[model samples]
Target: MAAPSSPPARPVRSRTSGPWAKLSTVALWMPFPALLWVGGYAGAEPRLFGLPFFYWYQFLWIFLSSGLTWCAYLHTTPTRPVRTGAHRPADPGEGLR
Candidate 1:
């Protein structure tokens, strides 16, 4: 008879410790409130490069959101240690093995 399999292992959780991680998480949520506040920037009085305030305000946020996302990625990602002592193999194929 076939042996029974053991239960699957739990997923390894990444360490998200530190104030930077917390701050990054908060930064990720900033775009939500900024975009949701339609009443604040809904007016057409303030024109940006001939575009109405409502259109330009949302368009400007596209770049702002991208920047915020990049910041969060930098803060939350685990950095790898630089391999200073390691040398590349003379034959690139040897390293693959």
Candidate 2:
């Protein structure tokens, strides 16, 4: 059997953790206006291959935003399941396997 892991990884943060994380997160959203303006103009330029530019632009984001938000959300989340057989520590006193 494999050796048990050390304690669950503890996230460490300094005093600036809050402001830094929040600032960067909020900053990521700050680019929407420019994307909209440019996307709008580009999308407004009639259809491409029979799809309207506006429609295409918005449609593009349907895929883009889902991916972006998913990426961002995952980024903020903690480590996920590992493919190996290892597992997280359970309730105290649970005997080691």
Candidate 3:
């Protein structure tokens, strides 16, 4: 009888912890609360191009939020290790042994 095959190796998961990690987490999450609270921008004293504060403020954030999200993505992502020829496996068949 043939031996049963083992399960494939799972990919390693990285856990980030540090000041930057916290900052990134906040950057990615802050937009929801800032936009959700209607009272914050419910005003008219400030106007841009004749638009009220509420309308213009939200539009401004639409662009700002995108920038913040990108900043958070950069902070949170891990740098991948470069693979050189010496580190690579010699052949696909080698793993089966």
Name the top TM-score candidate. 1
TM-score of each: 0.75, 0.46, 0.63
Query: Predicted candidate 1: what Cα RMSD to the true structure?
Result: 9.3
Which stretches of model 3 miss by more than 4 angstroms? 1-15, 82-97
Error in Å for residue 93 of model 2:
24
TM-score of 3: 0.63
How many clashing pairs does model 1 include?
A: 0
Candidate 2 — which residues are off by over 4 angstroms?
A: 1-31, 34-39, 42-46, 80-97
Task: Give all candidates' CA lDDT scores.
Answer: 0.80, 0.60, 0.77
Taking the tens digit of each residue's C-alpha lDDT, what string does model 2 give over 1-97? 5756655544543433465457547655744863668644564567778987867776776677667666656556545533454555565555553
- What range of 10 consecutive residues in model 3 has the weakest lDDT sum? 80-89
What overall lDDT, based on C-alpha atoms, would model 3 receive against the true structure? 0.77
lDDT of 3 by residue, 1-51 (tens): 344454554454343668878998888888898889989889996899899
Off by over 4 Å in 1: 1-15, 92-97
